[model samples]
Every structure is written in structure tokens, then in C-alpha cells.
Target chain A: MALSADESSRLGELLTSRAEQVTQQWTEIIAGQLRGRLSQAELVRQVQELHRAMVDALGKGTVDLNGEEATELRAVLAEFSRGQARQGFSATETATGVFALKEALLAVLEVDQSIETLRDYVAFSTLIDQMGLFTFESFVRTRESLIADQAEQLLELSTPVVKLWEGVVAVPLVGTLDSARAQVVMERLLQTLVDTGSPYAIIDITGVPAVDTQVAQHILKTVVAARLMGADCIISGIRPQIAQTIVALGIEFGDIATKASLADALRHVLRLTGVETARRQPRREA
Target chain B: MERVPILKIGDILLVSIQVDMSDQTAVALQEDLAERIVETGCHGVIIDITALDIVDSFVGRMLSTIASISRVLDAETVVVGMRPAVAITLVELGLSLNGIRTALNVERGMELIAIERADEPYDERDDGPIPEPTASP
Candidate 1:
């Protein structure tokens, strides 16, 4: 609800006159809600900043939070909730931090009991509720962006193309293969082949728990892309159950060599390159 | 039209595509490569596309057609040095460049051509099973 002109001015005057008392009570109420998780000094600082912004906004006769005059107030509230979100505070705790100002204002209005005072208190309470909702929105936004950043990092960390030999590289997939991750794996594997001039690549799925048809299609696409870049890719580390799943799903790897282990794939590559690896004989004891 | 230069290195003709492949340029390169193969009597053709950042469907089809032409002329055509991004884009576009052999680089391409040329007499006995190590007495 938009605050009326007289109510906004009177509330602004009351807040300005009792700024110290109102902020102290607001901080104390929030500290109780938090149960000592946030430091008293930091909480007090945030409460004081919020109090000044609110008084400034109301003094300018801002009817709603979206007014240009209340920009500072909106910024302060957003900053407060973003900090709470990063600090792992719940939405209710962050919103309650904004709502606590209403209780503080009510304490100040308790001395004057009239019909006008009750109306002013309700109008002021609605404004504080608007601020609480705004804080909740910013908190949720910050949390969502934080999650998106972590997921991007995980995608980067999951698809690492490492050099196994002079001309052989490997991508050890450790999680489920989605289209995005598969695209990353394909691009990275092909880039590594071009950068290192690797003629052979081994895609190890030993850490992958399952393989459906979609995953098989992704793997096949990656292999074909690598082959187009003039690198042979060997699908390795096929677990017994995963092998059975592949057959049951009717997914054909189609002439791309599949090995039981990375070692076998490497051996096949080495032999293809004419590198004979013979077993060493034991020395006789003297 | 910028003609792609075809250099003769031993028995393999190396066509390094340093220019962007326009429709006319691609057609011209195909014609020039076929004539060079016939005149030089080269047994292998290596088309290096390392500098090519983009390979659309047209270029992909050109490569396949050139491979077919060289094959009919008794020359093995190997497209080498395809960049990873181009390869991924081609696969995404569903163009595998069929009938065109591929190698990682020009050196590997030459090696591939050498192996194919010597395929009939090349011995596979060396890659046979290795004998087990004997136990010490």
C-alpha cells in the first residue's frame, strides 16, 4: 500500500527524531531472530544504514519503493539481502530483518494512542512489508545466480582432456553425460588433438554409473567429431553392466573400437603406432 | 578467384588451403587438384585445412568430391589438419565428409599415405603376440 503524504512525513519525522532508539531496537530484534549467528556490531551497522535510507526516502515523500527518491533505500535493502544470501541466511531471516523496523516503530508509536496513530501505524507497517518482500526477492536472485555459477564451474571441471601419452589423450568422464557436457567433451577432446597432434584418444567411462541411449548417442557424436579432426577415439572402461545396457538399448558404436579398459585401449593404440611393448624378464638370483 | 596452391612433396601433392573457400574457389581447387594429380602422377593427395576456421556444408561436400576424384585417378586423398571447431560444426551439421580419409596433420597424413601405398607388402608379423618371459632357473 502506498503511504499517504501526511503519514510519510510524520513517520519520517518520528524516525529522524528517535533514530538511535529505533535502530537499536531493530538491531536487537533481528539479533534475537538470528540467535547470535551474526555479530552484533555488523548487525547494528546494517540496521543503522537501513534506518537512514528509510528516513531519507520517507522525508522525500516517496509513496512507493519504486520512486526515484527511494532509490537509495532500494539499494541498501538489496545490498543487505545479497549479503544475507551469500552468508547462507534463510529468506525468512533476511525478510524479518527488514520487518523488524515495524516493531521498532510500533514501540515509538505506543506512547500516542489515537485513531490517527493506529492508521499511521498500519500505513507504516505496509511500507515495511513492501521492503521485506523486496529483500526476499533480491535474496532469491542472489542464490540462483550463485547456483548457476557453480554449475558452470562444475561443467568446466568435469570435462578435462588430459594427455596420456605422446600422441594419445584421454577424457575420463566421471558423471552422467548430458547434451551440454557431451558438447564440451567433444570440443575439448578435438582441441587437444589439434594442439598436441594426438592421433589417438581414449574416452574412459569407468566412473560413469550408467549409459542410456541418449548417452550413447552423445558418446558416438564425440567420437565421430574427433575422427573428423583426424584423431581415432577408443571407447574404454565399459563395465559389465554398462556393456549389457548398451546391447539391450540397441546402441551400436559402429566400428569405433571399444575396449574393456583404458589399458587395453592404450595397448591397441600403441600397437597401431607400431610401438611394441614386451613383458620384461626377471633377473636370475646370484 | 584465389587458387589454392598445390605443392608436390615427394610422391604426395600437398594442397594447403590458406584462403577461404568460396564456391568458385572450391570448384577451382577441385579442378586444379585433379589436373595436378594426373600431370604429376602422384599416388597420394593431402589437403591441409589447418588455417580454415569454418567448414560449412559446401566445403565439406567439396572435400568429399575431391576425394572421390583423386580415388578415381588412382590417388589416395587424405584431408589433414581439420580444426576441432570445424570438425564439431561439421558433425553438428550432420556432414561426416564421407569418402575422405583424414589424418591429424600433414606429417601423419604422409605417413598414412605411405602405409596405404605399401599395404600389400607391409608385414603384420611384428605386431603379432609377444612371447611370454621365461622363468629364471
Candidate 2:
């Protein structure tokens, strides 16, 4: 059955958060649950099959697993029942645990459905009715609504690391940089700069996606914000697409240092104080 | 470009791919997604692309990068429903996905994460071929 708008959004948020905690970050807590399973290979294959099921889910033609496939699975499991996990990581993947997990998740969803009365976001409810359109896309559109709920509630941005070096703090952004994140990055970096009383903050987005007007604006905002905090902000990691976007947007980052990578940005940042040789390894997300 | 939510099986964020996401929107999406991943606190993000025809390098890079950053921000990323052709392009580019993971389909990725969560081991056992579950007629 369909859940109410408020109920769905709330439940959606809960599920979303819990899911992220387990899957996104490596949790040391779940390590011991996978010691003994009825069968490991069969389970892995089951997991693989489940993923395959998500691809064409409804569309991929189906065959009854009840016939030969089920028999084959049993045979495979019998052949490979030695260990529950690979080299390591079994405490978290117990076969009984997985079976319970499946049941628990289904139970969770059921519980979530019971709270669907309050209207959280109208659009989210619309998404629910439109069967095929309510998955990941809703997450994108409903983001603004979600973020408005709280600062750290939505998604986790980098924990601003305010590094002090010769009275300067530098923040380097790596990986596919986008506008929304760039906005968040800008806010956090600037706030940290102000909070730490650092005169220079460097933002390296070499890892950012194709730069566009929005990203350029975000850079501009960071620079401006840093200036407001009585600090200087350096922009680096401007990819080709981003450069093109900046030019297209006709926005000039006045006095902003643009570099090719985080290392280049660091060199420039360090060179500002005539200490160009001070080199330390910069950490970038993978 | 329209965004759709397909299903959320636990922490796996299942999204329907936009058949046509422009370069700008693609980046915006990565941005938007970055925000969502942080907001929803979902563990894994899955983008199903069976409905899509052609996704440029921009989209691929954005998704890959977003997936990585999302993970750093406490979310794993997965691209599902990718057509075979799209898969070939991604591999040929020698893209730097590094820690970002993907599956032939969303369910597979979810299964992996779930199994990973379950800490299911490196099982050499092949469960033969899974018979496709029949869609309701």
C-alpha cells in the first residue's frame, strides 16, 4: 500500500540514513556476525543475483529458479561451505544474520509504512504514486527539502579540517566537485576559516565534475566569503570543462589562484609567503 | 531532465536514470546527489540506466566522482542498469573509480553491499545462473 506523504518522507529519511551507515562507511562493529553460515558461495551468488535483479528488475526476462537453478545453487553451496567470508570480514556477514537482516529490513519497511500520515514533501508523495519515478531521482529532487530539515541531517560533507601552517588554514576539495556540494564546501570552508582566524584558504576542485555557471558561482562565493572573514581563498583544480564554464559565465575570480591540482594549489598557497619549497602530501578523496 | 526514485531497499538508494541528462544537468545531478547522499544518509547510491541511451563522459565522471565523495561523506555509490555499451566506454576510458563500486544492475550492487554487510566471504561457489524472476504478466 502507499504511505502518506509525511510518513513516507520520514520513513524514507530513516531508511536512507540507516542504509548509508551500514553500506557507505566501513563499520568495525559488524565484523563478527559472519562467522558461520549455512553456505557462503550460495549467499554471495544470491547477492550477485539480487544486484542483477536491480538492473532490468521488472524488464529483464525471468525464468523460474524453482527448476534447475535452485538445484544448482544447492549443489554449489554444498561444494563451497568451508568459510563464511573471504580472507577476512566474517563477523558481519553471518548467513543467519543475512536472513535475519532481510527479514528485519522487510519489517522495517513495514513499520515505516505505518507512519505515513504527516506530509513532509508533496513532491515525494507524487513520486511514490508514479511507480518507476520514485527511486534515486526522488532523492535528487527532494534533496533541497531534506537539507532544509537540518545541516548534517542530509548528507555528510567533509569534516572541515582547519590546518594551521604559518598562520594559514587550507581546505582542499578533491573528487568530482559539483554545484550543490561546492555550495556546501564553500559554506563550511569559509566558516572554518573565520572560526580559525586563518588568512588563507585554498579550495582545490581538480576532482570536481564539469565546471558550470553554478560551480563558478560557488567558487566566487567561497572567495568572497573568505574575504569577508579577512582571509584569502585560492581556487585550484579547475578542469577544462570548468574553465570553459567560468569563461562562459563571465565571472572572474579576482586575485583567486587557479591551479591544475591540489599539489599545484599548495605550491601556490605556500609561495604566497615566499616559502614555495614547503611541501607536504595533500590528502584527496579517492 | 526528470528524476525518479525507483525503490529504496534499505540503505541502497535506487534511482531511475534520466533518459536524457544534459552536460549541465549531469554535473548538477552530481552536485544534487552529493547533497542527497549527505542528507538521506543512505549507505549506497544506485543509478539505474536501462532507460538511458547515451551518457557522455561528463555524466560518467560526475557519477564516479560523486560516488567517491559520497562514500567519504558516509555513503557508498553504485551505478546500476548500465547498458553494455556504456559499460564498455567506462572500462575503455580506464576511469579512476578507485573505491567506487558498480554492478551490472542495481540489485547486484545492493546484493554486494548487503552481502558485504553480512560479511559473506569470498565464496568461489558459483550459484550457477539465477533464473530471471518472471515479471508479473
Off by over 4 Å in 2: A1-154, A157-159, A162-164, A175-180, A276-286, B1-137
lDDT string for model 2 (A79-179, tens) is: 22223332232332433322333333343344444343223333333322232222223233344444565555432555354584764666656554565
TM-score of each: 0.91, 0.30
Pick the lDDT winner: 1
Going through the candidates in order, the fraction of native interface contacts each one reproduces equals 0.90, 0.00
Among all windows of 10 consecutive residues in model 1 chain A, the one with the lowest summed lDDT is: A31-40
Tell me model 2's lDDT, rounded to 2 decimals: 0.52
lDDT of 2 by residue, B1-137 (tens): 55544456667667677657767666666677777766766666777776876656766666677767777876666665544344334433544344545554454567656765555355333547789999999
Docking class of 1: medium
What is the fnat of model 2 with respect to the true interface contacts?
A: 0.00
Give the lDDT of residue A3 in candidate 1: 91
RMSD of 2: 34.4
